[model samples]
Target: MIRRLARFRQRFGIAGRKVAVRTELAWYWRWLGILVILAAAFALAAWMYETGRRFAGFDQRELQQQIRELERQNGRVRDELKGTREELESLRAATAASESRLAIERSAQHKLAQQIKLLERENARLREELATFESLLASEARVSKPLSIHRLTVQPDVLPGEYRYRLLLLTGTGRREQQFQGRLELVVSLTEGGKDAMMVIPEATGDAAPAFRLSFKYFHRVEGSFRVSPKAKVKGVQVRVYEGKAAQARATADATIE
Candidate 1:
């Protein structure tokens, strides 16, 4: 190795070689070459850095383009987010309105039910009151002769005085009785001058009824009445009540006549 360096120095015209080469002189030359290359690379890097600084504002258009793209994307995202929020709020409001309407309907239904119940109660009460009134009326109904006589002119009387009479039959039945129609028999007897006197049968006879349909529980049950002129001064009278051609339900002993 030393011989090789000596030979190299002699060739290079260095009597004493300041930098000696190793025995592997090829390897050393390559390493030295690499170092020189590295120094050249550093110089190039510095030159490039200085040149780029001088042209610093040249890429403004590209930067603006990138900024515009980003801004567009941001705007699109904001619009979409705002629309979504609005839709959600509208849905919430609709739901609230529906719920409020449902509540109102429920309240109305409850009130209607209450009103129906009240009406039913009132109707029932009214029906009961009407029934009570009807019962009272039925109980109080009785037969009455509120001046049941009418003066009728006839063709003849005792010595020749013609007189006629009209008999009206009124029923005093309670409210419980239904109206009826049938025959009625009213017997006519007489007493003259406050004494028992036989009434002479008149030449003409009036209408006579075998029986009468007397409403048992009505206000006015007029069975019927017979008109007769006995041509006697008899003033005493009597009356009897029967049902369905059977035994007497009521009998009148006697009554003073006017």
Candidate 2:
């Protein structure tokens, strides 16, 4: 019986040792699991920090580029504004100069118009005086006792070679007159005892005044022998306007060689 009790005690001691070893192993396993979870959490936090830093750098670069573009745009806008101001200034100056020129021209034209008006008034006055004198002469019912002229001078100093003598006879009331009925008569005799006489140059028909109009406008072509005279007192020009028996000569132009 004693021997059996000894064996039972040995067995109990071995079983108690086994249970203590198992408890130690369970505590070690629990500590290892806690360490692995802590390591995983730390690694995740580091990765998150790196990723956030990279993202912040990218955002900063983009913001800097946008700022540069805005600054460039501002500079361009300023330059454009300056150019527009200069253009406006030039336009203003041109406009002012044009207005000044226009004003000066207008002033000059006003003065010219005033002078023209005065000259017109003077011309009208002279015309009125001439009309008055003609009316006075016409009112006097003087008998048309053929007006007559004895001598007429064409030129005191004559030029050399074959010269021309245009005789002009002007008379009558100032109006477009066509009062001539017959032919004109004139005896052109030179101081050299040479007589060159002609009634009128027939080809000068267009030059004749409209009918009886008082005008001495006529063209006469006389050649050398009759006109080229060096004689001291050249020719006596006689112009008779009316052709009737009662002869009235308006005037005559005579030439003298000095």
Candidate 3:
């Protein structure tokens, strides 16, 4: 029996030899390998998602900053518009005031012009009046100091056989206090019955009513109307002034009748 067991060990090739052995893997080990692969894939996907989230945060911050800058620019534009409106209102007010002042100045200028014209006219009128007054003073000076007949005039009266005469008798300035009383007589030449004849106006028909009486200090105006014969045509007149109701004449003047 020992001899036959030794023969069997030798025949099975395990008598004194060392050799390696292999066996089929278990099912649970295959499942564990698959779980490890899936875990590695999940971990890679999580790392990619974290990187993308960081990039997105940076982009969002930049966009917010851009929006804030746009808002600031809009506020500045609004302020500029408000200031422009205020300036426009100021300009309008100044223009209106200037126009009003200009209108008032124009009105004042027109009034001044009218006043100047009135003053000029007044000056001219005053000059004319002065000239007329000076002329009168000159005439008075010329006739004031002489004892003479300054003027004589004669004219036919409205009556058929009458004549009128006028004379200006001037007294001397040297004898102002010596008052002179006188009588005036007029002598006229006429054609009566185809012959020259002489007649006296206001003749002394009676001593009670002498020729026209005259009394003066500086001057006297003598005037009279007298009648001649109806058949007489008067041609000339002579005036004589006598002193103090006397027949002796002091002055004589003559004029022609038209």
List the candidates' TM-scores in order: 0.32, 0.32, 0.42
- What is candidate 3's TM-score against the reference? 0.42
* Residue-by-residue lDDT tens digits, candidate 1, 189-232: 55445555443222224432333444333223232223344445
Name the regions of candidate 2 deviating beyond 4 angstroms.
Answer: 1-58, 132-258
Q: Candidate 3, residues 90-176: lDDT per residue as tens digits?
A: 988988998999999999999999999999997895585466445533675434544577557787788888777766776765656
Runs with alpha carbons beyond 4 Å of true place in candidate 1: 1-68, 141-258
For all candidates in order, the CA lDDT equals 0.51, 0.52, 0.75
Residue 92 of model 2: what lDDT?
97
Q: Model 2 TM-score?
A: 0.32
Worst 10 residues of 1 by lDDT: 145-154
As for candidate 3, its clashing pairs are: none
Report the candidate with higher TM-score, 2 versus 3. Answer: 3
lDDT of 2 by residue, 134-156 (tens): 55346532123222232233443
